[model samples]
Target: MSNELYHKCHEAISQGRAILEDLQQWDFETIIQYPQAEPQSTASHLSTTAMPSTEKTTLAEMESGLKGCSLCSLAKQRKNIVFGAGNPRARVVLVGEAPGREEDEQGIPFIGEAGKLLDKILLAMKLSREEVYICNVLKCHPPGNRDPQPDEISACEPFLKQQLALIKPELIITLGRFAAQELLKTTQPIGKLRGQWHEYEGIPLMPTFHPAYLLRNPSGKRPVWEDMKKVMQRLG
Candidate 1:
């Protein structure tokens, strides 16, 4: 097998082991709840006026309508807008920072190596991609895989808000610093934000390290698995 394939297999094994350990330690009766962070202000950047007319109900319709969007400069470089995917009625939604190279190319959210890691994580939770919707804060990828700019997020957040309104998910998991910070409207770093419960538009939100970060720093898998356990329990 190629070196890349070999490393991926090894990483999977390590992650699986961590998951098993977490499961072994889990107690169905004894709930371990983290302290709730301060409630974030519910003031939305996107008002009712920003919502598309009632005619655009389905995600497909919204995506189609946004085909020629040039709300931000990122649209200029994007091959395709990585619109969200998975079960429309999914109880959980995973939001990341923005589309990566692979995601941008495929016009699918979380379809890259990070996405594979995410699939493994969902499996660990006894969940599948089909069970949860996945998308990013920014649909179009930034140039050179850079961090999303404020203007870009401002231009894109309305659509994300619309998506949440449609999905009305029971819970949201924000991956990476940007996703968590942006949604919560906080300046706290991901390290402090993660492992604690927060809220977004009344739905429970959990912030955790992104799968891409875990790939770079495999040691982070343990904490991420812990976070997933909390998510599973909350969902149940």
Candidate 2:
């Protein structure tokens, strides 16, 4: 086979393997409780602090620690932790895949141009950042801001789960495909994931486009608006 065909075959095989792995772990009933297993160390430096105490550490302190975390390989390349910011006790939580260059520099989630668009969307819903919590599936920025690897998600998921447990939000808004897929544990495309309400550990989850994606594909905004309306209706 020619080199180009050989590369295509390799890509296909890799995708197949990923799908198989995703399917094997797609048990909706499995509730991942907190204070669970620790992640294996990566190239990034691990902190000396103990696992965040359920009660002792305030959300701010926990976030501070997370910002300094070096639990995964992304830490080595990241400029900042991109730990989520906003009202810790917010009723709605917005979860994305990971940080990008802008977010990494600011050490905040959803603050870039895409973040600005998100703000507009939230305002359209008559909501503000102070009213809701925003976070990413992975705390650190992935290289080139590419999609997060499965292992990276696995390593970072526990922290997000812990945050959810602590905040105990009424609803979760999964921004974009990665967040929806990881939280919902489905191989279905984002088109199917949207326009529906799913549950995660009893919290209502609404999937929508990532602001960054909407920046590229303006037409996607319509469905995302629909999803936001559902969130508003539920919250209202």
Candidate 3:
């Protein structure tokens, strides 16, 4: 594991555990603080002339649509759009939450420490990155790698929908809570939402623990692997 990933996972685990200690004494609303996004980048004006009105029919088309996209506030701060990479006609598509620091730097999704683990999971299923399409719910990395805000999701959702339409994959796998909740349109926690079959735009969808989560909680790897088995069978 990279030092950055290890440290992040460690911190998240520790902080999460600390919160659990006070689970019984929680006052729900105040405990969950929604942060207002400060000006992370100079806001840019979006021209509808550049935006795609009709559905994009190819990866190239989707790329064109995102080339200069500034529909949401994330556009100004992003290094690269992180459009997605893999077979355009892939049988499986995996959606993650948002680009992390490494991902933003590389302009690719799932190329960090968590991404390496995701590769192993794919290998376990007798697959490679070439066989599966990988992307995020949002194209841009959220400032500070925080959860994507509502406006960000709304702006990015159309692109994701376009990708799914073009690829027409047999299955879609959602990596973490954010992707799961966004795609499922639910407020339930990941613990309650994962390990079940869901659907999106007629394609079968599965929600599982993200590799980052597994990195922090090694015990989670087993259940994630179990989910992969089901994925393998479905692919066959």
lDDT of 1 at 90: 91
Candidate 1 is scored at a TM of 0.77
Worst 10 residues of 3 by lDDT: 24-33
Stretches of candidate 3 above 4 Å error?
A: 1-54
lDDT of 2 at 104: 86
Where does candidate 2 stray beyond 4 Å? 1-57
Query: Per-prediction count of colliding residue pairs?
Result: 0, 0, 0
Per-residue CA lDDT of model 3 for 49-72, tens digit only, reads 234432556798668656667777
Error of 2 at 57 (Å): 4.4
Alpha carbon lDDT of residue 209, candidate 1?
A: 100
lDDT against the true structure, per candidate, is 0.85, 0.81, 0.84
The model with the greatest TM-score is 3
Indicate whether candidate 1 or candidate 2 has the larger lDDT. 1
Task: Give all TM-scores, in the order shown.
Answer: 0.77, 0.76, 0.78
lDDT of 2 by residue, 32-52 (tens): 344545674544234332333
Highest lDDT: which candidate? 1
